[model samples]
Target: MEVDHRIRVSDGDGETTAGQGGVVGVFFARCWLRLRSVLVGLWCWVAGFARKVGRIAREDPRRVAHSLKVGLALTLVSVFYYVTPLFKGFGVSTLWAVLTVVVVMEYTVGGTLSKGLNRAFATLVAGFIAVGAHQVANRCGAQGEPILLAIFVFLLASAATFSRFIPEIKARYDYGVTIFILTFSLVAVSSYRVEELIQLAHQRFSTIVIGVLTCLCTTIFVFPVWAGEDLHKLTAGNLDKLAQFLQGIGI
Candidate 1:
């Protein structure tokens, strides 16, 4: 009887050990599969990115060159602000020139010109309106000025927001309208210090102009990419491809 009991206890211990081993094996197998999947996904992403770079190098070197030119232009703007004594007084606001360049620059000269002009015109209009509004509000005395300003801001904001949806305005002058709204808000809201508003507007306008000119010069002078040319090429290529396909199908 004693020998049988000892045998049974040993059998139970062996079964438990085997069960734990099986569970551990399964866990490790699942972990390995997950790790392998992750590695494969990472490899695929790297390969795709490498292929894209190669394609760009082979087929569209101009795009890469244009990007480099943009970088050079931005660098020049930064250097001008940092090194020039005339811009030193503007301090951190000098960065606005860089911002404007980034915003206005496009893949093509026409697009850049369109956006630059829009931004400048919009800002000019908004600034003038803000100045006029400020003058009018001031005459109403301290008591009524805040209330009147609030009403004015509300009305302008609402109008600007709604105007964005107009098809004609949105097509060409959308950027301009958006800029007007933004500039209006900034200048109008900051009207408490009316004395400094004009200087601020001047500084911003000059910075924007500098950015626009820089973008235009670089885009035109340095390996220019014309939208019209690109469009022509694309249309021609598509037609050629279609003709080839039709020929292949005996059509």
Candidate 2:
């Protein structure tokens, strides 16, 4: 005789063997998926820090003080990213935007307040374009093939237009490129939600502001690194090596 597995509660039947098997399978699958997601996130975080460390090691000839400075500065600023709610909601976009501004300002703009302002402006502009485009696309019912085509066209146009006008940009085209890629990538990743896109636009700007301020504070408080140092150091090293080579030749 088969067991009557159904338990009739107030509304309907509660559980049968089939339902139990499905629920159990779903539970295991969810657990597996969550574990995988956590593992991947951890891996990426570790890889990012490792890459930062490696780059600093390779670039800093005065490896001791500069590396320590870089590490402490990054750590201090990154505290906001990991510990604050402002950056928490933006997810990967926050990290990408912050890293873009930080790296560019560090190398090109002397990481000053002006560069922070530039980053904030660029980020807001990018968010505006992304959110506005998404809203327009949604209003027009552009999805599937139409959406893809529109995105491709927009990308090509953005590149062409910016390439022509980028000469006047103070920080050059790096900020423009960062905005372009970030806008397109974020739009692509979070597609077709007009309301959500609006929310994202707001969140992106807020997080970017937080990130830019973090960088500004970091640069101001820490031993600020500059790109001219590399040029000066390289020139000095070349001259020293040349003098040694001349002495050896004379010997």
Candidate 3:
């Protein structure tokens, strides 16, 4: 009988008597990949976001840059939660909520209450629509397609109706359109289970809440800057440039 002499290797915290380096290499590679993901996220914020803010910074460099820094730092910390092993789910929810609140606050109202209210309403609407669609689909055995189409049409009509009553609706028509799309789109996307829909809604709302809080806290404590400031900086720059041009023209 011939004896084979290839030693088996295991990954037991460097306790393998054979000392194979392959397992160690693999473990190190995984760690590196995770770190790289976080670094990529940071670079994305700095390169794309910071530069845009910096352009606005030229007008009121200190305040604008400070606000931008605070917002980005908070956002980055939120993103890190997703990349890390234990905290990713919470991070995702927080990031989504924060982003939603930020967008709504930028356009509609500029306070924590407004941000929270819009996000909560959006989540509730999504949940209710999803649950209803699920029930209709399960009962009809059609997987909710018919219900979805009807809901979509109804939402569109409702948005149109709101356009007349709410001037903001007409001013920002796409906002309502987006909300309608997202509300029903989830039904088709989800498994059409009431429990699942409820869970999703909870997650959506919870994340939004966390995100809104993070944004508000960061704004107040760290570098509270407003959209008006952003607009003001940009406008002032243009005005200054115009004034300089007029002076050159001897007007």
Best by lDDT: 1
- Provide backbone clash counts, one per model: 0, 0, 3
Which residue pairs show collisions in model 1?
A: none
Best by TM-score: 1
Task: In angstroms, give how far residue 135 of model 2 lies from its true place.
Answer: 1.9
Question: What TM-score, computed on C-alpha atoms, does each candidate reach?
Answer: 0.78, 0.50, 0.49
TM-score of 2: 0.50
Ordered by TM-score, highest first, the candidates read 1, 2, 3
Per-residue alpha-carbon lDDT of model 2 for 142-247, expressed as tens digits? 4453575367546755774576555565246565555656665566447554346666677667766666666666555656666688679889999999999999
Q: lDDT tens string, model 1, 165-190? A: 99999999999998898888888878
- lDDT against the true structure, per candidate, is 0.83, 0.62, 0.59
Candidate 3 clashing pairs? Answer: 93-207, 97-208, 98-211
The TM-score that candidate 1 achieves is 0.78
lDDT minimum window of 10 residues, candidate 2: 100-109
Worst 10 residues of 3 by lDDT: 104-113
